[model samples]
Target chain A: LQALENIQLDLEAVNIKAGKAFLRLKRKFIQMRRPFLERRDLIIRHIPGFWVKAFLNHPKISILINRRDEDIFRYLTNLQVQDLRHISMGYKMKLYFQTNPYFTNMVIVKEFQRNRSGRLVSHSTPIRWHRGQEPQARRHRNQDTNHSFFIWFSNHSLPEADRIAEIIKNDLWVNPLRYYMMGEGVVRSWASERQTLERPSCFRFWIQ
Target chain B: LQALENIQLDLEAVNIKAGKAFLRLKRKFIQMRRPFLERRDLIIRHIPGFWVKAFLNHPKISILINRRDEDIFRYLTNLQVQDLRHISMGYKMKLYFQTNPYFTNMVIVKEFQRNRSGRLVSHSTPIRWHRGQEPQARRHRNQDTNHSFFIWFSNHSLPEADRIAEIIKNDLWVNPLRYYMMGEGVVRSWASERQTLERPSCFRFWIQ
Candidate 1:
């Protein structure tokens, strides 16, 4: 009878230990959930109204994401004529955005390259293109280049740049192969036009 | 007395609205804080003991928390020899990580260019040093050229090459202000490793 009682006591001890372990796990889980939920809400709240509406109107029963929603934003902005040609595939986009500082300017550029044999092969060497928000009159006169792909959003402050960068960082979901970030003060000078590749020449590393 | 009572009631209504607004803001604050705290904790937990011991030994009481801790992990792992230059810099660091199958290599290369005025400028361009990590090593030993700087990183994939191209996108960063990302496919077709001012004929868009 005493042995039976002792066995019951041991079982109760084991149950209590298990309960404690479960509670600890519960606390950690709660801690983990808190941040994830908050970020989810933040993302949902900050999506542009136009994007939301456009997505709703899509025939596929959801939103359609254009190139503007892609990972190429920060890299594509503030390009120059010299920088546009390296983009081998789509050299013909005609739309252009001028830096607010220089109303006469009408383009932006980003450069990309690929290795061929032992040599570096670039289509345009330094790819250049027109920013997408120019008036129709300006665009037609600049007919030498195709301007089909440029998209424009209002330029925000550095903090906004940081937020956009964060979104890019978090949603690097499609291609987990490369990650990129702009270096501190690696942007165009304050006096420079936004649509020109007049960024300061300095050594800045891009995260890959 | 009735009018005075109505005024007090209006004040109570205003207070209630204010309280509701405050509550909403408080909820948002908590929401944002939840993810930040949890993410921070997750980061803290993953740090290895060696770093903890190192940091504890040399705590900078006045240091600002500017960079993410994951940057250290990037510096340690997936690090190619090209990163050694920046790691030599004692400034605060930023890091980005990737695990793409195509990201097989990293290398460092120097580019030399002459500006419009014909002034020679030398700059180091970090190439995605992959299978052909150092073309300059072979070229420097075999060929004799008066190029200002002689180094280059070579890689197999264009996307991987872009990872380095993105780092040195600024023209002002390096003078004659030019750089290149040479793919192995392109370099293999080059007629000669030694090309120069007298031999513009050797210059080809796709060098192999």
Candidate 2:
């Protein structure tokens, strides 16, 4: 009877150890899954406008580029503009960038579409001519007079990206803005200096 | 009286528009905040036990080194052994590598505390001896029998840096696994495979 009782005690001790091990493993996995869920939720909330949803939901639409690539410029510019004709049918076409050297350094290209008399009218402004310092002539030419649409090349300093993105958020778009913080070395100055804003979401498009 | 009524109506309309705009902005901000929050949470949760609060938290810990200039042989054999007394208060140290040959590639080092009495002890087995292909007999002398940790060197086919990172994640450690997925040109050979198992919280000791 004593031997049997001792055997029972050994089994109980082993079970407790196993149970503790199981709990630890389970906790680790739970911790791992949390980050992935958060990243997915972030992408959905920050995506621009109703058109983005339409594109994401469309059966025909596909993700062209998954990761950042140098070829992104050529891909966007070289793609036959005809592919965009269909986009004009249902949604107003617009682009937005904040002034940030790393995030969206240059506007690259900004195209807008207007529905006039049942026909799609398109206009595009490319931020090519002005590379380094913005010439007064380019600034005057680049000023967005038509509030309906404009592309922000957040192609400037840290403060510039924040300022432009905030200005546009207040003035035009109905979407929330995401500010990309640089991880390491930063070079080049894009926008004039300004105080860093506390909250990234506060910048809304407010037209006076 | 008619003019006064018209002005009042205009004021009311303006208020309604402003209210609607506020609501839209509020909704967008909430959505945008989700992803940032998620990413932050992920960083917090999977940050590793030895690095912060949880199991085996030590006050005096050494940071991991990014040995980019050294080869795998040099990293494992020479670098880890150098100035071992300075790493911890006599506790064997473990090295973490930031090697992934795929999407994101980074090389980093981390030091952990020791717990000899713990139920499950981790062993980083010495897997790669003579660096891919030809056998160098001298390398075999330093093989680890204790098997307390594992270091994954990036596969050259999958961009040396990125592949090394992926292999490390698949084999050892959990969350905050710095790695990149394979791109078009990158390939994984039969030899360069993953080696990891679901182990509970453990210690890594550095030995010369």
Candidate 3:
């Protein structure tokens, strides 16, 4: 009887131990809590920068990089970009990456146009697309080269636009890659029809 | 004797089952493997996109978004970014992010000036910045307006540059927030720079 009692106690003890271990592991990796290091310190600190640069630039250690790859550390795997209807761990991480500021800004810009009826506001006419909600014609032509320059500049500079673009199918987001892909199409649709890309000396920022 | 034998068998079975469960849990969450559902589908999938957009764009839901917060989800935590001489989960994730394409390209651009000796090759003359260890002077002025425009544009479009700038105090990365903070100092540095904030016609892509 005493031997049987000892065996029973040992089994119960192990069961309890395993249960505790399982909970601890789940909390450590599965919870939506803050990470150990903060963003500013990670990005601004010299030591961290050194490691990132070395990991990225080292020919031997950073072998994951491809010659033609645009963004070196870009996280656009096919699995990562798929339709995420179901609730899986994959969905959880995606939720974190998608709503990030870069992607959201792209969405806002895409929505800057259409009204409640989703009508395309003509360039020549002044319309209160939002704000006061008044039907007024556009006072200034949106074709200013400066605006185009800014757009082009933003597109070329930030890979975020492309990542955000991958998240949406329709014209509901400002996709820099798609815009650049438009090529001459962009040159044709000038709201105010301000200036052209002529004059070789016209400060071509795109030529590298 | 029968009871003791039965008890022994039950303990063995329970031990095996617990062992199996522990392995399953580790493989499911602990290992650094790619999640299912491709990247494009994950972001572009209507269901996932809807959730993300609702979570991010909804003022009440995505209150975390500030200006240019896309990279906030980006996991360059300080400990991860630090010396990286140490091995860790943060190190592993950072390794994945840095060796990715976007980051490497940025590094190439950052190293555009260094010669074989990692010395600064001045921008006034024709120089082989990229070489088989040959030293040369730069063909054009790095301070050209076009260069300034490209740098300025990059700084505003993505926060990566600023984060990188923090990693290195020098001019390798163009940090917009820091530049903006310079304010009057920047204006003082540029005399021939022209500006026409005409008619409130500015198309700010940032304001949501």
Candidate 4:
């Protein structure tokens, strides 16, 4: 039994080393993808309502957008996500919007950072809502349904917000065109219809 | 709109490059972890009932094991998973067993490979059961409840089998000690009680 315990200790040390190595590889991969992501941002800006349509097609993010939130999303010009140093350190997401009735803030930023103790610390720029135009404030605080998507920015205490951020960073940001195509009715659903679409040679690359 | 189309075409080119790069990084990461995993296997073999206990702790795998299957699991000496060439290409799992009354085979191997057109093709060694000792054959073919876990080896048509293989490869094989600890009642559940356990300095590393 003592020998078995010693072996277990040795395995744990190896596991920790493996975990650190995996993290380093992940950080390098993130850095390598940055230039392409920046190029994607430039191209996507020319396509009207690209980000909003992409958001509307996402299963989780779509459900979060209420009627008022949908209206607000029409003003969304661009969305950018950046890993702060390394992904383990944390990430920042910026949502750029044109002048709208809902909020005066041109760009709303949400940032999540891992503190020394490894607890997640989140901060978001407060949405300066024009009087009588605050979408989240209009919804009853105790209500369970129909909360605006903007509520996610302020409600950092809810663990669901963290999950939403992950979806945005990993899923929506990675392949916005897939979702946008779904919203355009080019495909029936994300998974099943992936291979069913017939497109020109130029568009075929993105279909898969 | 033509300008937007051209930009979209450019974006697709970059996206394809990014996807290829990500796959390469994932393959490299898998190779780097292989040596540590081999060491883990050697240590775990010294601990009796390690694989069986780990299987019982897994929510999906545990429910799959009927009474007869549990008995068969007791004879299991080791389980190993290996990615073939690249992860995208496919993987294989080998389950080693001591000479047991139920089957003559000392090792059972299940392999999954991607065909030229990218469809998954799976193959497994036929379990040679002693006459009337086949646990899976005894269960009513149409019955929904209490099917033996060994049935998974024969039923390649079921998509659920593919998912189970993924769990074994990615979750069970990665950290068997965590599941084994849960089986020992050292932790109430896998995720919730992860941080509650207090151990001596020598054992502290595996607790997390």
Candidate 5:
């Protein structure tokens, strides 16, 4: 009877260890699936700093020439645009912060300008961005007048539009402005909006 | 006495729940410190593919010319190189895979030829790769006997090289071949190796 009891005890111990291992494996899978944090040279903090330069390492961007139309819009992850201010030196474009209280990162191609080196010369404007509010175009700076730079933020996955959207949605800031989100994933929803916002080749975004 | 026993049982239940919560918090903190994953056009799966392409979309690449020397090599994430294959095309370059027996991704600046617009022409050679072995350069392809291609992969932490270095060291692959890594973090150790490998501007990695 004692030997049988000891065997039972050993089995119980093994069961406990197995249970813990299972839990750890489950947690590991969940951890891997969880959205990761994105560290860029320049991070637009939701909390504003006293300085005008809100970005950390103001990243220089470049242009990809002679690719297919479809390929041109792809790969915006570390995509850089240069001298966008020349589009409208002091123009304010339309943008919004939903999932995140802050409209952190936006890839607007038209306004971005590049040198022969394909480096972004234009500085990303900070004033136009506000928390829990919709971004608007500056009519006064109306250099082109019709230029509306619309940007989208997705969940906080750190890369792609969806995660940023998720981050924004996690906070749940539904604005009472003109905004429509259409699509299933992060890249698609934002890309859909981008296609809608894209106009003719008149500084339309790609050509410029 | 009955009421006291009931209260004790309730306390034990609460204790169990509290223990679980504490574990979760501790794991969360650890997760925050862990490195993130990079989502790209194609991820050579560490696992075998039931799917042909791991990533949803392939990204477009671009070339940046006439930038400062340091600036030229600054962005390797999406930085494009055109006709780089000419550097030592059909050339011999040495490589190795430690933690991962496969050096999955290689950025061949010169060998990776692109069109005028900037797209990868040469599909990265898969012949040199094996599941659990170090890679060897193709001597027959060594048109230029002096050419060598070296690369580094860092953890996706948004910023910082050390996290990647930690990831690399976590598995610890000490090879018999000549290799030296020096850095407080991820960017510097491999960077030092790059400085040594760089021969000249004849499609020298930083320029071309």
Candidate 6:
């Protein structure tokens, strides 16, 4: 029994080492991918309604946007997710908006981080909603199941907000082009589209 | 509009480059982690009923296991998943078993790989059942929702098989200890247990 416990300890030690190595590799890749992400952002900005359409095309994110949210999304100029040095530590999301009647703020930022105690905590900038212009208050009846996307800005320490951030970081931020094409009705079949986009000739080189 | 197309093309080119680099990084890390995985296998082998308990503890995997399957799992000596050079190309799963009354084969191997046409294909070693001892033939009516785990050995070109392979590769193979602990009733609160197991001091070094 004592020997068994020692074996378990050895396994745990190995797992910790593997996890650390994985994080390091991930961090290195994130740094290498930064310039490409920046270039993508620059090109995507010139395309009108790119970010809004991409958001609408996402199944999980789309359900959260109401008609009023769509109106606000039209003014969205840029969407950026910062890994905050390392993805395991936390992430920050920035949504840039043009001068709009709904809010006085030009950019809304939401951040998730671990405190000193190692508990996950989150906070976001308050949306300076213009009087009688708050999207949350003017709920669309047909979109009863949906919550106003603006409400996401004020959501702190909620699982729903965490889920949305994950989708944005893992899905939308990684390959917005897929969603953008979906929104444009260009992708009639998902499987074929995915094959064309994801499986490049370069992949064959990795096989050995 | 023509210029927009050019920009989109440029973005796709960048995405392809990023994807290639990511795969290279992933392959490198997988190679580095091989020795640790082998060491883990050595330690885990001496622990009786470890793999069976781990399988029973997994929610998605548990649902597919019947009582008769449990009997067979008792003889399970080793479970291994080979990435087949690179994860993107495909993976192979090997289940090593001790000689038991139910079957003559000592090892069962299932492989998923891309064909010349880039279509995914799969094949597995046929289970040679001892006369009148096939678990699939003897269905337990009470376990209507569950399929015999042995049925997984024969499944080919199925999305369900693909999903199970993904779970085994990504979830089970990566951190079987979590499930093993859960099976032992040592982990009551998942969130707290996850924090204790996953968050090591080495993680702090990667933050900067």
Local error of candidate 1 at A35, Å? 5.8
- Residue-wise lDDT of candidate 6 within A11-42, one digit each (tens)? 45655565566566556656655666677778
Docking class of 6: incorrect
Clashes within 3 Å, all models in order: 57, 50, 40, 0, 36, 0
- How well is each residue in A68-92 modelled by candidate 2, as lDDT tens digits? 2112222221111111222212222
State which candidate has the highest TM-score. Answer: 6
Point to the candidate with the largest lDDT: 6
What DockQ class does candidate 3 belong to? incorrect
Q: How much of the true contact map at the interface does candidate 6 reproduce, as a fraction?
A: 0.03
Q: How far is B78's C-alpha from truth in model 1 (Å)? A: 22
Task: Looking at model 4 chain B, report the run of 10 residues with the lowest lDDT sum.
Answer: B199-208
Residue-level error in angstroms, candidate 4, position B65 = 2.9
Q: Residue A72 of model 5: what lDDT?
A: 21
**TM-score on alpha carbons, each prediction:** 0.18, 0.18, 0.16, 0.51, 0.20, 0.55
Off by over 4 Å in 6: A1-25, A32-50, A53-67, A88-93, A99-140, A143-208, B1-18, B33-50, B53-69, B88-93, B99-208
lDDT of each: 0.27, 0.27, 0.24, 0.66, 0.25, 0.67
Order of all candidates by TM-score, from best down to worst? 6, 4, 5, 2, 1, 3
Chain B TM-scores of the candidates:
0.23, 0.22, 0.20, 0.74, 0.19, 0.76
DockQ of each: 0.02, 0.04, 0.01, 0.08, 0.01, 0.08
- Local accuracy of candidate 1 as per-residue lDDT tens digits, B86-155: 1211111111234422223333334333223212233443434335323344445544321211121222
Q: What is the lDDT of candidate 4?
A: 0.66
Question: Chain B alone, model 6: TM-score?
Answer: 0.76
Worst 10-residue lDDT window for candidate 6 chain A reads A199-208
A114, model 5: CA deviation in Å? 14
Question: Candidate 4: which stretches are off by over 4 Å?
Answer: A1-4, A51-76, A79-208, B1-50, B53-64, B88-92, B99-106, B109-137, B140-148, B151-208
Model 5 in CAPRI terms: which quality?
incorrect
DockQ of 2: 0.04
